[model samples]
Structures are given as structure tokens and as C-alpha cells.
Target: MIATLIKLLIGLLLWVGLAIVAARIVFALPRVQDRIDSTALDPADVGPLAATLRVRARGQEGKTGIAMLRDGADAFAARIMLADAATASIDAQYYIWHDDLTGYLLLDALARAAERGVRVRLLLDDNGTSRLDAELAELDAHPNAEVRLYNPFNLRRFKLASYAFDFFRLNRRMHNKSFTIDGRVTILGGRNIGDGYFGTGPAALYVDLDALAVGRVVPEVSADFDRYWAAPCVHPVGPILGQARRDGAIEDGLAHYADDPQLEEYLEILEGSEIVTRLSAGDLDLEWTEAALISDSPAKGEGAARREDLLSARLLKAVARIESRFDGISPYFVPGRAGARAFKALRKRGVSVRMLTNSLEATDVLPVHAGYTSKRGTLLRRGVKLYELRRKSASRTPADTLGRFGSSGASLHAKTFAVDGKRIFVGSFNFDPRSTMLNTEMGLLIESAAFAGNLHDAFDRELDGLAWRVEMDGLKTVWIDPESGEVTRDEPGTTFARRVVLRVIGWLPVEWLL
Candidate 1:
């Protein structure tokens, strides 16, 4: 029995050693260690799109026209409509694009746009886009459509092996989300391409926000996208995923599912939405403002980026310009010791620093919540006000609005903040270490008191009903329900099983990964 046990241990060791060797060999064989270069086409003079936008901006030079898309349905509609309207080029990049209702819907629009001779480019991080290999390959095969994967995994089938070999590089991701069409309009913010983001899916819904932008910012957005598109970490689908067999609907070039009951409802909602109609007519109600894009360099993933190229540095510069109040909204809030000290300094200087993030009960990524909990005491003790969003019901959400892709409002996903009630930021940046050091992020910093005040106002009024306040009773933490003035000693709406998961993950030394 002792000899048999020794043999078993030897066999396991041999297998593990062989697996590691194979993984490293596979990782080096691909373009993961190499750079691919490609040039992006200039924004075409897309007839009606440019003509109408030009008329609208006849007098507004060097200013961006921005419109808020707080409603999930409106955000979804805006993307679909823009895709359909594009006659020149489309550039879209995202961290997550689920293989669900909304994902397919948007892909269909892109494929249709490609059929009509429009240039379509889709750049997605390989991390969050599992089970999308076949569809992505098909899209890439299209003459007018191209797809690129960022920081991709070479061992597609054996992801574990890939991670084992290249965990350091794979850990960093491109978390930027932006969609530009005809080089004239762009939609950007916290939402990824997923059902939960748009309020539909089996997963819990995300409280999200997006901004449809045009004018001066569009060029900036396009230029920034070009930099990422030409980054060394990016790879074409052909080299990594290989060629896909053009079959089924893609081969036959079938028509869209306009008649499908699931898609029809959303089409009806789009027809009724004011965004698409006003956008096409050049009469969209957009606020003109001076907007600056803050983004991390594509080189950040390789740890070779300059400090000045980081989004955090740009944000700190922006924050330095603030005087009185600051409201930071992030679903994944993991303020490390450094962030705590910074906030403490801000507090000492009389800045009313407030933050809104997911509560334990409302957070979908429980591990992130664990990381956030570690800093709560430090932040609250240092005079930073914290609000945790509650898991909300679907009473306010419409079935048709989200379609089959909708979800219950169970988490906060919007990453935005108001600075001194004069400047506001909205984008895919989360206030966590991952966003700071492990991922590339982008957002618009608008110099508009009105837009910034809207966020501050919501925190004072609407958020009181949607979120609970986190306070400290000496050294003990408690949650206060603002609506009923009820205080709870433990996390609100959390189950015993979930608490166990949270505790287990909290004990793990994985704060850097969060």
C-alpha cells in the first residue's frame, strides 16, 4: 500500500510537470508574445449622418453634444439604431459581450451593416467573451466586418492551461467600452454588451448609465479607439481563433429576426423611443459642453506605459481642480490603503467626499464586495460618506424595454462621479485596483455643472430610496435604511449561504485580482 501511494504521487507530479511545459510551449507559439499592426480607415463622409450632424453643429465649434441614457432600454435602442443608420464605418470595443438576446441582436445589426458596404470593427476582450468563438469568427470572415481580440488566450479550449502559463499578462484586460458609427457619433459608459447590463438576462440586472456623444468628442473618441486598435496586445481573430466555417444563417445571408416575438417587442420600443427619431432628424436634445477623454494607454497592459498615460493620473489631475464636493459612483469599489489616505486628505481639506457602490446583498461579484468591505471602515472613519445600493425589483422595468435580455435590478454597474458639482465623468472605470493597475479604462470628463449637479441631486433625493447608508458605531459597522430610518447590524438582504461565500473569499489574499 505504501509503494502504491508513492507511485500515485509520482504519476501526479509527472502529469503536472508535463502540463505546465505544454502550456508554456503553446503560449509562446502564438501571437501573444508578438505585435500585429493594422491601420484603421478614416471616418467616411456618410451622407445623411454627416449632413444632419453638420447642420446641428453649425455654430458649435470645438464642443461636444452629449445626451444621457439612464434607461436601459434607451441605451440598447441607441446602439441598435446607430448600427442600422451607419453608412460608412463602425468601431466598437467592449470587455464583455454575452452570447444572449441583446448580444445577438447587436451582432445582427453589425452583420446587416456589413452587408450594406459599411466598415464594421469589433474589438472585444477575450476574458468576458466566452462561448462567442464561432460567432466572432463568422463576423470576422465577412469582407466588410473585422474582429480583433485583446489580450487573448491562445489555448482557447484549455483556458486553465493558458492561465497557468501566462497568468500575469492574462490578468490585465482592456475594460474600455465605446461604440462609434460613421465617425460622427459615439455611445460610451459603464455598460458592456450583455443582457444584465441592459436589464434583461438570467443574471441580475445592473444599474447602469451611458452617454451618446457627438461633435468634437467624437473625433477624440475615434482617435483614442485607433490607438487601442493598433496596440501590440491586440490580435486578429484569424491568427488566434482560426477561420470559421461560414454556415447556417451567415452563409445563406438570412434576414434579421424582425418577426420573432422576442425581438419584435424591442423593435416596437425602439420605434417609440425619442433617441432614434430625433437623432436621425438632427434635432436630438443634446447639451453642448467642453468634454475631455481620460484613458489609460494600451501599453499599460504590458506594464510599459508612462505614468502620465494612466487614467488614474488624469483623474487625480481632474480631482485636484475640484473645490468642495465629490461623488464617486462605482459598482466595484475597492479603495486600497493608498486611496483611503487620498480620500482622508481630501476630507481634511473640506471636500465632502461621497461614494455609492453595491451592497453585499446587491453585488453580483461577491469577491469584489469582500475587497470593498476591507476599506469601508477606513473610508467611513476618515469622513467619506458611503452608500450601498439595494437589490431592487422589476416593477419599474418594462418587459418589452429589456426584452428577453432583461434582468432584475440586483446590482450597481454604473461607473461615474461628480466633481465639485461642476465636472462629471461617465465610463467603464471602476474605483478599484484592477481598474487602476490591471486594466485599461476610458471615460469623458465634461465641464458642465448641470450634468454634475444631476448626479449630486440624485444622490440626495432618488438614491435615498434605492441605496442604504453605511455608518460606523464606534468601531462596529452598520447599515442604515434611509427610507424607514431603520438600522441593521449586519449586511442587509444577505443570506446565510452568501455570507459564508463572502467570508471564505474575504480570507483569501486575492485583493490584487479584485
Candidate 2:
């Protein structure tokens, strides 16, 4: 019996080894032929809207028109208006696009735009859209629309098996979020296309930020889209969905929303928005400033070894120029040793640094919270004024209009920072190792004191009701809520089971991936 058990164990090990080899060999084989002519569609052909925006931009003498999108309703309304107003082209890229209410509404608008002869190009990360393959292929069936995926897996059915062999390549993903219309206007920031981002989700709402930019920077954003659209890592959907198959799935899917009352109400709400009206009338409240659109090159993922090409490196150089104060906001704040040391060095130089991140009960990813808690003591000891957002909070003031109507819980997802009240950075670049080394990111750095001051004011006004201040009592840490003046020795609002899980996860050596 012992000999038979040993033989069976050996057979199992050999089978597993063979499976790994097979997976590697299959994934290594090229699944799609590289496009010979990798040229992008011309943005100059965009129509009269582009001409008007250029006239305005030239009037500002290279300064871009920037408007901060603080409210979720306003953000969603702005995108829908842009899609409706586009005359020639629309380009969009996102990390996540769910098939929920907001997602379908926006997609239906895009489909309508395509039907009217407007060219549409959509680029999405494969991992985020793994379940929407058929829907994306149907959308690609439109003659005026094209869909592409970045770094797709070869074996679509057995994704876990494929990951075992191609873990390194598949782990790196595109986390960019941007939308452009007519090559004239662009919206870029931390918000992805989903109900939670737009404040329509049934559960929690994400308090996020986006920048509506028009001017010379729009062309730069368009150029970035073009780069990604033409990269070798992108694969067209036509090849993924084989030929000789026309089932009208795309049309049928869209037809489901033809007379949707919810969609009609959303459209009505957008039409009545004051911001939309002002935008349509070309009377925008824009802070014209000299802004630099920074992005990591597509080659950053194609095995390029140059650190100079990294967005994080560029941001660090900007951070080095901070003179007095630095305020950072990130939902996933896993500042590894290097980041911690940088903050310490800044503090040593008499710079006041403050950060706002998610608390244990508020965070969606427990592993990330574990990594963050592990560094809480060191950061607090360094005199960093740290604040963690509460799971639920009451609205404080009129300026606390950062969420959607009826939003129950708030999750901090905005990635923004202010330097000495002189410059402001906003985008999808989280302060984590993954964003620093594994993914591509983009953002705008505006040299505007007014913008920076506005952000600072908003941060201050929302602090009392929205977050809990972290304080160290000798060796023990405490969370003090400013609104209620209540103190908690343990992680606030966390269940016992979750606390145990977090404690176990904290002991794991996985900070690099968090």
C-alpha cells in the first residue's frame, strides 16, 4: 500500500509539471499577427468643435482651460454631453467598465454616435473586461467603431491555468482612464466607467475627482491614446471573435435600453445640469494655467529599462521641488520602504506632509489595508498628519458636495496631491508599488495657486465629518473621530473576523504586490 501511494504521488507531480510546460508553450505562441501599418487615425479631421477649441486655446497662448469635476452627477453628465456633442471622433480608455446602469447608458450613447458616422475607438485592459468579451466583439461589429484589448490572455476559458505560466506578463495591466471627443476636449482622472464611480451604485459610492480639460493639452491626450491604440500589445477584437458569425447580439443588447425609463431620466437630468448648459454655450468657468500632461510611454511595458520613462519617477522629481507642505490623497496607500523614507526625508527638511487614505472598515481590499496598517506607526512617528476615511459620515457643508444623491458609504478613490499650495496633481496614479512599477499611469500637473488652494480648502472642510485622525498613545494607536469626539483603540467599525483576517494578512510578505 505504501509503494502504491508513492507511485501515485509521483504520477501526480509529473502531470502537474507537464501541464505547466504546456501552458507556457501555448501562451508563448503568437495568437494574433502584428499589424503591418501601425498608424493611428488622424485627429485633425475632427470637425468644427476642434477648430473652436483651438481658437480658445490660442487666445490663452498655450494655457489650457481646466475645470475641476468634484460632484459625481456633474462628472457623469459631462461625459454624456461630450459623447452627444462629438461630430467626428471619440476616443475612450478605461481600466473598468461594468455592464450596469451607468455603463449601459454611456455605451448606448457611444453606439448611437457610431451609427451617425462618428468614428469611435475604445481601448480596455483585458483583465478588467474578461467577462465582456462577447459584448465588446459585438460593439466592434459596427463599421464606425473599433474595440481593442491590451495584453490579453491566450487561453480565455482557463484563465487561472494561463496565469500560472504567464503570471509576470499578465500581472502588468494598463490602469489608465481618459476620454476624448473631437480631439478638442478630454476628461482624465481616477474615475472609471461604472455605477459606483458615478454615484448610481446601490451600495457604496466612491468620492473621486476628474479634470475636464480643453486646449493644447487635449491634443497631447489624444496623442497618448494614439500611442496605446497603436502599440504592439493591443489586439483588435475582430480576430478574437471569428468570422462568419452574425447573431445581432450587439444590437439586441442595446435594444434592451431603447425605452429604458431610467436612461431617459438620466438624460433629462444631464440636460438640466447647469454645467452642461454652460459647456454647450461655450461659457465655461475655466482656470487657464500652464499644465504639463505627463504619462508613461507605452514602451514602459515592452521591456524598456529606462527609469526616466516612468510617470512615478517624474512625479518624484516634482515632489522634490516642494518647499513647505505636501498633501496627498490615495485610496490604496501602500507606501513601501522607499516611499516611507522619502516622506521621512521631506519631514527632516521641515516640510509638513499630510495624507488621507481609507480606513480598515472603509477599504475594499483587506490586503491593502493590512499593508497600510503595518506602516502606520512609522508614518505617525515621522510627524505625518494621517487621516483615514470613515465608512459612513454625515454631510458637513455645502462644499461637501463630493458624492451622489443618497450615497450611504464613502470610499476615497481620488489620487491627488498639492505641493506648497503652488501646484496640483490629479489622475489615476495611486501611491502604491504596483502603480509605481507594474502599470502605466497619466495625470496633469497644473501650476495654479487657485486650484491648489481650492483643493486644500475642500480637504479641510471635509476632514471633520468624513475622516478620523490617527494618533499614537505611547505604543498603542487610536482613531479619533472629530465629529463625535469618540476614540477607538482598535480599528474602527471592523468586525472581529475581519480583524483576525487582517492580522494574519499583515504577517505575510506581500507588501511589494499591494
Candidate 3:
């Protein structure tokens, strides 16, 4: 009996030892070896025409129409241009294109472009377009247009195991938005094609931005598009569907659905779909600037730029170069300790800083809001002017304006920043860690005084009404303290579960993946 007990104890010790070694090996394999060196723009790549480009700052149609303010306007403009001209081909890549009015409008615009005898190539992430299978097959029926889903997981293509085998792979999504019009204009940035982004109606809207570039920048955008188009991950729609033979009725059903009288009513709700009206009405004053299209070149090594992944680094470098002041605004703010320290160093340099992010109640993602609120005290202590947006329906602010038949209120989704009234950065790059580390984001670094000043004025005028200033009281920060307006002090600790989850996540060495 004693010998039997000894044998059992010895076996348990061996199992535990093996488990520890296996865990260490698994963790070590995924660990990133080094930090990426920030890349710089090549002087040759800046192009000569950019030197002569004239840029001016223009306001949006209304507070609720902020989507028309950025890439939505540009994309709409490009689609129109393609429809009007473009005899050869058109290509677009996007991460998200919601199956709402805005998405349908884009679809209609593409159909019109095809109707005008233009070959249209639409590449969308599988994760984004999988649900729109019926819509996609309908678009594919077009003789001149082709819609392909990248890295599809559907069993129709013999990829059934891909669905059940791996779930984490889905999280590593194709978070890129790019479009090329007649190989002339290139629109790249973070704004997905949806009404929520275009200020259709404040349903947990995110204040985001995108960039539109003409001239030489378009080619770079085309290159990125081509890379993804050629990638094995992106399979042709015709071949995939050719195998599935999903049936002919799906197209007829979608056509009938499009003609539904309710769609007209739905269109009214999505003001962003009125791209043609805004463009024809001269809502967007096209600004030309000395802008060099910056993007992440394909990854080579520890610091090598990855495909459609370099824009984040370029934006950070631009932020780092700010000499006098740095103002940032985003709907989401998830800056960890290192990011907080970076802001602190900027404050230490006597740089007047201001930032606008969503409040707990204003945010749709409570956990993300919690992550941001966690850093409020740290940010406030460093002299950062942090503002949490308030619900405009409840509060009487000067910025509120009745928009779209008193239905939609303004939600700030504009990703813009101004530096000393000289340079401005606008596009999809956000201040959050997710934007910085994981997601591949794009935007324009505009060095135009006119653009910067106009954005600055808009922000100044809107902040007083649409947002509440975050201030430090003692150890905590407050958004709307019943007594002291918006003050900051010590915040409550995270729940035990959240703490445990965050601790485990913090140890993950996937900064490259973010």
C-alpha cells in the first residue's frame, strides 16, 4: 500500500512539471522579439504636384452630417466620378459596410457605375460581408461588377473546417478601407460604409475619420488594393458561387427588397446616403494639400511595415513631431500606462493639450469606457484637457441643432486633431490602444493652415455644448458630479473578473497584433 501511494505521487509530479514547460513554450513562441522602428516618408514619394496643391478648410452640412465631413463625402464623390467617367475599371476594399441604407446606396452607386460600362471590383472582409451573402450574390449577378469575400469560412467553398476549427483567426480581421476610382482618386481611412459612421442617427455612433487623396497617392492605394486582390485569402466570387450554385432566386428577392417602399423611408433616416445631394449642393469644399500618402509597406522583419498596416505608425510620428500644442478627439479612448506616460511627457514640455472622448453613459461599449475611465485621473494629472461627451437630448448645449426631421442628434465621429494652427491630421486613426497596436488604420496628415484652423474652430464651438470637460479633483476624475460640474478624483476599482481578465491580457505579447 505504501509503494502504491508513492508511485501515484511521483506520477502527479511529472504531469505538473510537463504542464509548466508546455505553457512556457506556448507563451514564448508568440512573443514579439522587438519594437518596430517608426518609418519616415520618402521625399521622392511626396510627389511634385502636392507642392502646388491648394487646400482649404470647409465645414460639414450640419452637426448631424459629420459623416459627409470626411471619407463618406469623398467616396460618394469618387463613385459619382466613376459613374460619370471611368471606362476601364473600379475597385474598392472595406472592413465594414453595414447592410443599411448607406450600404445599399453604395451598392446602388456601384451598380450605376457598372451600368455606365465600368468594371467594378468590390473586395470586402468575410467577417463583414458573410452575413450579406444574399446581397453579395445579387451584386455578383451584375455583368460588369464582381464582389468577392476575402478569406471566406463558408462550407460552400470547402472551408467548413475553417469555421469550426479556429475562432481566434476571426478576430484578426481585415480592418482596411480603401477605394480606387478609375485608378485616379484613392480614398483610404477608418470610416466604414454605414449610416452610423456618417451621422445617419445617433445609435451608438463613433466619432471617426477617413482621408481622400487625388493625384499620385491614388497609385499607392491601388498597390495596396492589388496586393489584397492577389492574396490567396481573397478568392474570386464567381468560382466560389459557381461551386455553390446558391440559386437564382436570391437575386430576384434582393431586387424586390430594394424596391420596397419602406426603403425610401429608410433612406430618409440615413442622411449620409444623400451623397449626391451634398456633393451637388457644394457641401464639401475640396481641399488640396501637400499630402503624401503614407501606408504600411509589407512586413519584412521586427520593424518592417505590414500590408495596409503602416499608417498607424506614420500618424504617431506626426503626433510626436507636434512642437507647440496637441489636440486629440475620438469616441473611444483606451490609453494604457505607457500611452498615459506619453501624454504626460507632452504636457511636461509645456504643450497645451486637449482631448475629447466618450463618457460611460455615452459609450456603447461599457468595458471600453471603463478602460478609458481607468486612465482619466492619469491623463488629467498630466494637464490633458479631457472631455466626455454628454447626451445632447437631455442637456441644453449651444451646439445642438435639429437635424433630419428632429430624429437624429449629433454624435462626434470625426477623427481629427490640430497642432499649433498649422498642421492637422484627419482620418481613421484613433487614440485607443486597439487602434495603435492591433488594427490597421489609415488617414491623411494635412499640413494646411486653412484645414487646421477650420477644424480647430469647429471643435472649440462644439465642445461647450456636446461634451463635458473632465477635471481632476484629488485622486479621481469626474464627468458630471452633481455638485462640482465635471470634476476628476479617485475612480472605483475594476471588478475582480475584469481585473483577472485584464491581468491575463496584459501578459499577452501581441503588441504587433494589438
Candidate 4:
């Protein structure tokens, strides 16, 4: 009986191994190769908006017109306005585009633009849009619009199965977020298309930032969009989902959003938005400055040779130029050994290094918070001034007065860093191993003291009400609430179950994956 049981166990192991091998072989098969459409579309050929922007940018030369979008209402309104005003092309890319209220609103706006003879191209990461394959395919049925999924999964219905077979290939994702209109104007930063990103959700609202840029940087953004759009890894929706159905679901979806009573409140907010009013009147206050576009190569995910042109390397070089101070704000910050060493080195050079990240209670991803907790002591000991955002926070800035709707909670979702109050870096790049080695990211490094100083001042103003100062009391870490001066030795506001789960997860060897 013991010999028979041993043989059965061996047989089971063999069967499992065979199944894994078969799955890998099937996943390794060449992906569907459809016709490559590499036709170039110029944004300059767009309507009066592009022409006006070009004329305004002519005298600036290498400078770009940049306006900060801090309010969620204004951000959403700006996108809708750009889509409405676009006459030639609208290209958008995001890491996450949920099928929620804000998502449908943006989709409806894009579809209406396509209906008006404007060309629309949307590229979203496959992992973020996997559940919306049929809906995206339906949207692609529009004559003037197209949608593509980046680094798509082979088994769309059973994505978990594909993960088991192609973990290496499926792990890397595109974390870029950008919106371009008429090839002349673009907005890029951290916010994704979802209700949580905007301030319209019943749940937590994210305090985020996006820069609306025009002029010299517009062409650079357009080039990046074209590169991703033409990459072989991007799969068109029509081919993936086959012949598009002519069902009226797309129309129904648009109508559904239109009839939403909450939209009236949003529309009123849009009408009163200062950015929208200024944009509509052609009198936006845009600061013209020299900005460098930094982005990871698409080849980063294609298993190609490691290139020196990676965004992480460029960002490190940029950070090395800091002489006085460094202020980093990231929603998911997991600075590993290398990052700790870098921060220590900076502190040795007399550079005051500070960071503000999501707290245990504020973080949406518990694993990432655990990853950060593992290195909290090391960072504090290395003289890094760390601050964690609170679940309840005040407005980011005085200008962000338009979007307040008494949210259930507030979470820090902005990804920005400043160097000596001279330069600012903003985009989707997080201070984590996943962003450093596994994901493709992008950001704008503006060499303008005015913009950097403004950001720094805003950070100072929001520090007390929105964050808790973290410090080491001898060997123990403590969180001091900046508002009431209250102290908490434990993870503030987290439940017992969550704390236990986080403790278990902290023991896992998955920091790199987080």
C-alpha cells in the first residue's frame, strides 16, 4: 500500500509538470500578426485650435506652454473640452481606464468626436482593460476610431491561466498616461480614467496632478504616442475580438451616462471651472519653460538587450544633479536596498531628502504598503524624512476649490518629485522595483524654478492637514499626526484583519513584484 501511494504521488507530479509544459508551449506560439498600419497622422493639420496654439507657440521657440491641473473637476472638464474641440485627432493612453462613470463619460466624448470626422486612437494596458474587451471592440467599430491593447494576454477569458504559462512576458505592463488633442495640445501625469481619480465617486478620491502642455513638447508627446501605437506588441481590438457587432450597445452606453443625474452636478461644476472658462476664452495662464520628455523604451518589455536609454537611468542622472534638497511624492513608494543606498548617499552629500507616500490606511494596495513597511526602518535610520498621507485630508491647493464634494476619504495618488526647488518631475513613475525594472513609464522634467517653487509651496501647505510625520523613537517607529499632534505606534486606522494580512504578506519574498 505504501509503494502504491508513492507511485500515485509520482504520477500526479508528472501529470502536473506535463500540463505546465504544454501550457508554456501553447503560450509561446507566435501571436496573431495582422496588417501593420503605419500611416503618419500630423496634428498640425487639425482644426483652428492647433493653428491658434501654433501661432501662440511660434515666438516661444523651444519653450512649451504648461498649465497645472490640480482639481479633479477641472481635470475631467479639461479632457471633455479638448475632446469636444478636437477636429482632426485625439490620441489617449492610460494604464487604467475603468468602465465606471468617468470612463464612460470620456468614452462618450471620444465617440462623439469620432462621429464628427475626428480620428481617435486609444491605447490601454491589457491588464487594466481585460474585462472591457467586448466594449472596447464595440467602440473600435466606429469608422474614425481605433483601440489597441498593449502587451495583451493570450487567453483573455482565463487570464490567470495565461499568467501561469507566460509569467515572464505577462508581468511587464505599460504604465503611461497621456491625452493629446489635435496633435497640438497634450496632458500627461499620474491620474488614470476612473471615478476614483476624479472626485465623483462615493469612495475615496485621489489627489492627483496633470500638466496641460502645448508648443515644443507637444510634438515630442505625439512622437511617443506614435511609437507606442505602431509597436508590434499592441494588438488592435477588431482583430482580437473578430468582426465587430453592430449592436446599439455603444449608443445605449452613451445615453446611459447622459441620463445620469450626477452628471448635471458635474456639468455645473464644469461651467464654474476657472480652467475651462480660461481655456474657452483663449486666455489660459500658461508658463512657458524648457521641459525634457523622459520615458522608458517600449523595448524594455520585449526581452531586448538592456538599453542605457531607460527612464530609470535617466531619472537617476537627473536626481544626481540635485545639490540642495529632494522632495518625492509617490502613492506607492517601496524603496529597496538600492534606493536606500542612493538616499543615504544623497544625505551624506548634505542634500535634505524627504518623501511623502501613502500610509497603511490610505494605500489601496496592501502588498505595496507591506513592501514599504519592510524598509521603513532602514529609510528612517538613513536620515530620510518620511511622511505618510492621512485618510482625511484638506484640499491640495487654494486653486483646487472647485471639486469638493465631501468625499468618503482621500488618498494620495500624485507622482511628483522636486529637486532643490529648480526642477520638477511628474508622471506615472513610482518609486518601486516594479516601476524601476518591470514597467514602462513616462514623465516630464521641467527646468523651471517657478513651477518647482509653486509645487513645493503647495506641498508645504498640505503637509500638516493631509499627512503624518513619521520618525524613529530610538528603535521604534511612530506616526505623529500633523494636525492634532496625536501619536500612534501601530498602523493608524487599519483594521485587525488587515494588519494580520499585511504582516503575513510582509514575510513573503515578493517585494520586487509589488
TM-score of each: 0.90, 0.91, 0.69, 0.92
Best by lDDT: 1
lDDT digits (tens) for residues 1-514 of candidate 1: 9999999999999998898778677576365444445455666565667778888888999999998888877898899988998888999999998776788888888998999999899999999778778888988889998899888886778765577767888889999999999889999998998767875435567778888898999888888888988888888888787788554444232244445565666666678777877887988889998998889999997888898889999878965666789988899999887888889988999988999898877777888998888788889988999988766632232221112223445677889899888888989899898999889999999888888887887666636466788899988999887778889998886788877877787788898889
Mark the 10 consecutive residues where model 3 has the least summed lDDT: 59-68
Better of 3 and 4 by TM-score: 4
Query: What does candidate 3's lDDT look like per residue over 437-499, in tens digits?
Result: 544455666667776765566556645455666676565455543323544342222466755
In what order do the candidates fall by lDDT, top score first? 1, 4, 2, 3
Better of 1 and 4 by TM-score: 4
- Candidate 4 lDDT: 0.80
The parts of candidate 1 lying over 4 Å away from their true place are 1-19, 27-29, 32-40, 201-203, 249-261, 393-408, 495-501
Per-residue CA lDDT of candidate 4, range 212-291, in tens? 98888888988888888887777787666666665654566556667677778677866776664565456898888888
> Model 4 — which ten-residue stretch has the worst lDDT?
396-405
lDDT of 2 at 245: 55
Give candidate 2 regions above 4 Å deviation: 1-15, 27-30, 34-48, 158-161, 201-203, 243-248, 254-265, 302-305, 394-405
